[model samples]
Target: MSNPAISYAHITRVTDTLVTATEDALAAEEPLEIRLVHNGQQQSITVTMRSPGQDEELAAGFLFTEGIITRYPEIKTIHYNNNVATITLQPGITPALQPAQRNFLANASCGVCGKTDLDAIFAPVKKTITNIKVPAAILHDLPALLRGQQAVFDNTGGLHAAALFDTAGNLLHIREDIGRHNAVDKLIGAALKQELPFSQYGLLLSGRAGFELIQKAAVAGIPVIAAVGAPSSLAVKMAKEWNITLIGFLREGRFNIYHGQEKIAL
Candidate 1:
C-alpha cells in the first residue's frame, strides 16, 4: 500500500463503446480537524478535507495564514491522530479565536467559503515584499518547471500543486494535495519550518490564482505569484494593493501580468 494521501483502487474505464475494468491511483481526500490546546483548554478550530501527507505542515500553515499564530516558536508542539491535529501553544501565548477564525470551515477547494464578512476573512497585511524581479524568460518557463515537479499529479491527475521558487527560477519546495489551498499551505508551512525568507521568491500555482490563494501568498510575504490559469478580480486587486506581482495564463512562451508589472522584466 502507498501512503495515506494516495490510494490504489479498481476502476471501470470506457473507451468508445468498450468498457474495461482496471486499477487506478487516486488522490485520497479525508477530513482533517484542527484543534488548539491552550491554558489547559481544548478547542476544535475547524475541519478540512485534504490529502493526508504533510498533515503537520497543513495544520501549521492553516494557523499562520489565518493569523492564529505569527511565528513557529509560538507553538509548543503539534501532534496528529486519526485526522485530528492538536496544537499546543507555548506558555504566555494566548489563543484568541476570532469571529473570522470561528467562521472558517477550511473546505478543501476554497479556504474562505463560510466566512461572514470580507474583512473577517482577510484584513490586508501591510506591504512587505520588495525589489524581487524575475526575467520574462524565467517567468514564462515556470509552468513547465512546476509541471515536471508534480509527482502526484502525474499519477492521479486529481491533485493541485504549489511550488516556491527563487528569483533565479530554481525550485525551492513543492507540495501537492487534492485541494489547491492545501498544496499552498503545505509549501508555506514547510517554508515556515525552515524559516525561509519569502521576499526573494515567487510562488507558482498549478491552477487558477484565486483571492484565497493570493491572500495566502501575500501573507507569506511572497513577492510574486505566477499561475497556469487565470486570476480572479479580487486576487488581482489584493496583489496590486500588497505590492505582489500577479501573473496568469502562464504558458510556455507567454503570460499576462496583472499587477506589479515591473517585477517581471520584459
Candidate 2:
C-alpha cells in the first residue's frame, strides 16, 4: 500500500547553541481539485489542501455536505486524475454550483473560510433527529476511543481525525487528514459508499467543532457531535437549529453540551 500521508525526512534541530540531525515523519499536505460533471456540464468545484489518502471519499463527502449531491445514488462515478477528483452525477440531477464559487482554495485548518454567507453555508438537513440517546459516560469515553485509532496522528501529530461511533460507544469508522473537514468528509463518504444510516451514529472530532463541521454532520443526519476543543458561537447556533447534540471541551471526564442535551443521558 502506498502511504501518501507521511514522508520520512532528515531535519536539523538547533536549540540552546546545540545542533543535531534527526529523522522525522512529516504530514503530507497536497491540493485536491474536485470537479463535478452533471449531464455533460463540467464544473471545477473546489481545490482543497488535504492529506493524500481517501481522495474519493473526500470528494464524495465534500459534495454531499456542500449540497451538490443529496443522495449517494446521485453520484454515478468518481474518477481521479493526478490531484484532481472528477465526479459524475447521475443524469438529470442539478448540481449546486454556489459552493464552488465561495472559495476554491481551502486550507487545512479552516473549514468555512470560503463561504459567501451564513445562510448559504448551512445546507438543509433532511429532518431533525429525535429519540436517540447516548450515555454521558460513553460520551466522555469517545475522545479516547477516537484518539486510540488515530494511527496517523500518532506518527505525524499533524493530522486531524473524525470518527463515527454508535450509541453503545463502538467505533464504526475513523479517518485522519491534514484538514479537519477532510477527515470528516472521508468518514462520511465511506459511510455513504457502504449505505450506512447516519442516525445511529455520533461523530467525534479531534479538534474544535466548528459551524461548518456541525453543518456537515447535520447534512448527513448525524444527531451527535463531540469535540475535544471549544465550539464557536455559530457552531452552537447551527447545532441547536439543526437539532444536533453538540458537545465540546471533552476532557478529564467532563464535557459541555451546547445543544440537544436531551439526547445525552446522565
Candidate 3:
C-alpha cells in the first residue's frame, strides 16, 4: 500500500530568452491531527503539517520525542484515517502530558513551534551512553548515502530527511518530510516499530541541527547526530550537555565536531 507523498502542478518556466510551460513535482504537504485514546476517552493532542506518507510512524515518533510515550508497547494500536492518527494506549498506561506541553501544535518547520519558555521546552538530560565510535572517513560518506535514498526529495527537492546508520556506516532506515524535526521523528518512529537498537546508530539530517532535533535524538537514545548544515548555539549546548556526538557542515569529506569528539575516530 502506498500513500502518495508527491503532488504535481503545472507551472510556467521563465529563462533569459525562453518561456515554457511545464509540469513540476512538489513534496506533498498536509495537516495531520494526532489524537490520544485511553479508557474510552479520546482527546486531540497536537496537529502538525507533514507530507502524506507514514502517518502512523510520524505520530508514534512525535509522541516519543515529545516525551509523551517512552516505549512502543505503550501504544496498543495506531489507527489512521482521513489525515488523523489516533494512538490508543495500552491498559493502565496514562500519557505523561504536562500542562504547558499538552497544547503543543506546530507547522512544518516547527523547531520550537512557538514554545519560548526554556523551562517548559527543555527536559532534563537523559544521561545517554555517548561512547560509540565511527571512523572519520565513514562519516564523510554518509551525506551521499542519505541523499541517494531521499525518494521524495529527489523529485521535489523540497523535503528534509533523516536516516539511521550503524557504526560501520551501513544505511538502515530513512524518512523524509518538509519539516526537519518531522523527518527525525518519522525515522525514529520507523525504528521503534521494529524495536531496533537506537543507541547503536547515528542519525543523519538533511539540514541544520537544531536544539529540538538534539532533544529528539537524546530521547531516542541515539548517540550520534550529523547534519548537512550548521548547528545553533542552543543545539551545540544541548548536545554537549547530553554528551551526544554532534557534527555539522558534513559534506565534501569535511565536518566540524561541535561536541562529542571522542565518539568519532579521527
Alpha carbon lDDT of each predicted model: 0.86, 0.88, 0.87
In the range 1-266, model 3's lDDT, one tens digit per residue, is: 44388989999988988999999899899999999998788988778889988889999998888888889999999999999999999989988766226456689997557454657676534767645788888988899999988888888999999999888889899999998988888999999989998888899998999899999999899989999999999999988888889999999889999998888999
* Cα lDDT of model 1 by residue, 1-266, tens digit: 56777888898999999999999998899999999988888888888899998999999988887778778888999999999999999988986467346555666897887677666788346587478779887777778888898888888889999999987889999999999998998999889988999888999999999998998887788889999999999999988888889999998688889988888888
Poorest 10 consecutive residues by lDDT, candidate 3: 96-105
State which candidate, 1 or 2, has the greater lDDT.
Answer: 2
Better of 2 and 3 by lDDT: 2
- List CA RMSD, all candidates: 1.6, 1.7, 1.7
Q: In terms of TM-score, how similar is model 1 to the real structure?
A: 0.95
Task: TM-score each candidate.
Answer: 0.95, 0.94, 0.95
lDDT of 3: 0.87
Candidate 2 TM-score to native: 0.94
Per-residue lDDT tens digits of candidate 2, residues 1-266? 64889978899989999999999898999999998899888978788999998999999999988877878899999999899999999889998777536654889987776777766666757765567899998887888888888888888999899999898899999999999999999999999999898998889998998988998999899999999999999999888788899999999899999988889988
Candidate 2 Cα outliers beyond 4 Å, as residue runs: 14-18
Clashing pairs in 3: none
Clashes within 3 Å, all models in order: 0, 0, 0
